[model samples]
Target: MSDDLLKRTRAVLPSWLAIYYDEPIEIERGEGRHVWTADGTRYLDFFGGILTTMTAHALPEVTKAVAEQAGKIIHSSTLYLNRPMVELAELIAGVSEIPDPKVFLTTSGTEANDAALLLASSLRRSNQVLALRNSYHGRSFSTIAITGNRSWSPTSLSPFQTYYVHGGQRYRSPFAGLSDGEFIAACVADLREVLDQSGGDVAAFIAEPIQGVGGFTHGPDGLLGAFAEVLRERGILMIADEVQTGWGRTGEHFWGWQHHGFVPDIVTFAKGVGNGLSMGGVIARAEIMDSLGANSISTFGGSPLTAAGALANLRYLLEHDLQANAARQGPVLFEGLRKVGSPIVGDVRGKGLMIGVELVRPGSTDARSADAARGGGPGEPAPEIAAAVLEATKRRGLLVGKGGLHGNVLRIAPPLTLTADEAAEGLAALVAALEECTP
Candidate 1:
């Protein structure tokens, strides 16, 4: 039956699109952090659907809310008020520090970001948006224009020439080993150059609180705050693209940028905003959002089902105190990985549950010989090591994801529901995978 299903899917789907893995598994069901294949194989999901399943899959409360909402109504155009939408907005505002926040719902992070970008650019009457080189905003035209990753922004050149600024990421910092102040100064200098070079055309300086796809990496301490200060000075609105890092994933606060002591003019969240349901939004300072009142809106945005799921997911995360749990378990997992002490483990960096393990050519091994044997040409970024590690982990019934421009970093972002014992199990599997993949 499973083979027949796979054959049917293969026959129906287009072959030109890239598959995520060399071999893809036919996942049948999920609960908590585990997923079962159609053939009865269970795999522990460390990536959590790319960190979208914050509350984990098949959460009873969220499922019940979604079902109940389905019975009532699915969607009402933004032109009319919906009960669940209002309640969801209130719930989000209650958790945020922003007073009198206004919410604009969308179906995905990309649309949310696109809406934010349009608002920011329109309000400031500026065409340039400054973003970090390693950061990801989303894939739509306006959002992708601001996204810094080349993989997503793949044309030889952007038609609109979307401007960007640099941020302080210490792992591969432009100015490594600098003090926090020095690093921030460098980042600010880059922003200044971009702004000046663009003849002050910059409207907003946008960034992720901590870069999620860029190896689950943390930015320099106080770097975001410093950038905010610079933006304030230059009249550039600060936007936090917290789509991946928000909602207590960082543990210190509900919003990822809160730990930095800075508030964004516009904050967008998706991914786990609805705990795996299709929902996203931009929470803005009331004044900023109001400025764009008539300029933008979504047809199916703020649907009752999405709102219900979001409210339930938010409540569940808050009620269970999962943020604090992420904080506690993050260090435990980090310490265990560090103790394993493989030479291939070049760096481990993150906050809370969002972690990145950077793999490099181990100093103890002959890098050239290893690359030759692994079929990776010289200076090919060593993502082959990451791939081998992932394959080995999967063999042991564990799953994880790779990130970084080079795909050489292992990203560990399990559901917020992760337990200490479960973390230990996942970490053990990772360690074993590393040992197996090391030269």
Candidate 2:
């Protein structure tokens, strides 16, 4: 059955649209933190549909709200008075830390970021932009221009005259050995040098508090705050692409950027708000959000059905204190992964529910070859190893994900409601899988 669906899907879908595993699993249905394939095989979900199922799969409140809203209306365009939209916006604005916040709803994170790019370029009146060295904002042509990773961007052309800066990945940095303060200073000095060469203040300095597609790695805690101070001096707007790092997924803060001392001029979000529904939005200070004078409306952005579902999901997340759950459960997950003692697990880091486990070349640690392996190096990122481990885990009734610049990292972002027992079970399966692929 799965094979038939895969064949049919390939017949219709674009080749560039990637799927997980060697043979794709046809997800038929989900409840809570587990999903069943077409073959009736159930697996405990670790990726949470790429972290889209924030609270959990098929959450009752979200489904009920969507059903209720759909029973009345699906969409009425952006021209009408959208009560659900307004309510959700108000809820977001209240929590958004930006001063005098305003919300502009969109259909996806990509569109939300597109809207943010439009706002920044218009308000600052310059097409020059600054982005982190390993950041990914979105897939749109405009957002892709600011993305630093070449593998994802696909094209050299850009809507903005973009410059990539350092400080996204501290692990791979030349400055990796420096202290946090010195590292921040070094990055700031580099920024100055880059700006001096450009001879202009960039329109905006866009970044992710924690880079998602760049192996889920991030720099020292205050790196962005340091950059923010410099960008602010030149009146450069700061755009926080919080698509994956928002909604208390990072645990310590409600928003990822909040881990630092700065508040961004614009924040874009998506992929979890509606608990499976398509929804996203941009939040910013009132001044920046309202800068453009021309008329604009998203025909399908703020659908009442989506808004209702998102609002209910938001309520459930807040009421359940899922952030607290993440904070508590995150350590358990981390510790278990560490104790797996697999030489493939090189580094495990991230905050809250968003964690990244970097897999390195196996046999790097050995009794006789220990020195040789250490001298031979961090071993090229082992994507094939990661792929094998992913399949092995699935065979064990556990589902996980792989990512990174070389696609060698395991991204374990379960629902915020993850339990200690579930985490332990997943960890055990992960260890078994890692061992299975160790050779």
Estimate TM-scores for all models. Answer: 0.92, 0.96
What clash pairs does model 2 have?
none
lDDT for every model? 0.81, 0.86
Off by over 4 Å in 1: 1-18, 156-160, 293-296, 364-380
| TM-score, structure 2 vs. true | 0.96
Over 1-439, each residue of candidate 2 has an lDDT whose tens digit, in order, gives 7788889889999888889988899899999999999889999999988888999989999999999999999989889999999999999998898899999999998999999989999988889988888788889999899988877889998889998888887655666668999999999998888888877757888888888888788888888898999988888899999998999998888899998789999999999887778999999988888899899888999799999999999989999988888889888887877787777887787888888988877655322332443453344477888888889999988888777777888888898888888888888888888888887
- For candidate 2, give the lDDT of residue 269: 96
RMSD (CA, Å), each prediction: 4.0, 2.9
State the weakest 10-residue window (summed lDDT) of model 1.
364-373
What's model 1's TM-score? 0.92
Worst 10 residues of 2 by lDDT: 365-374
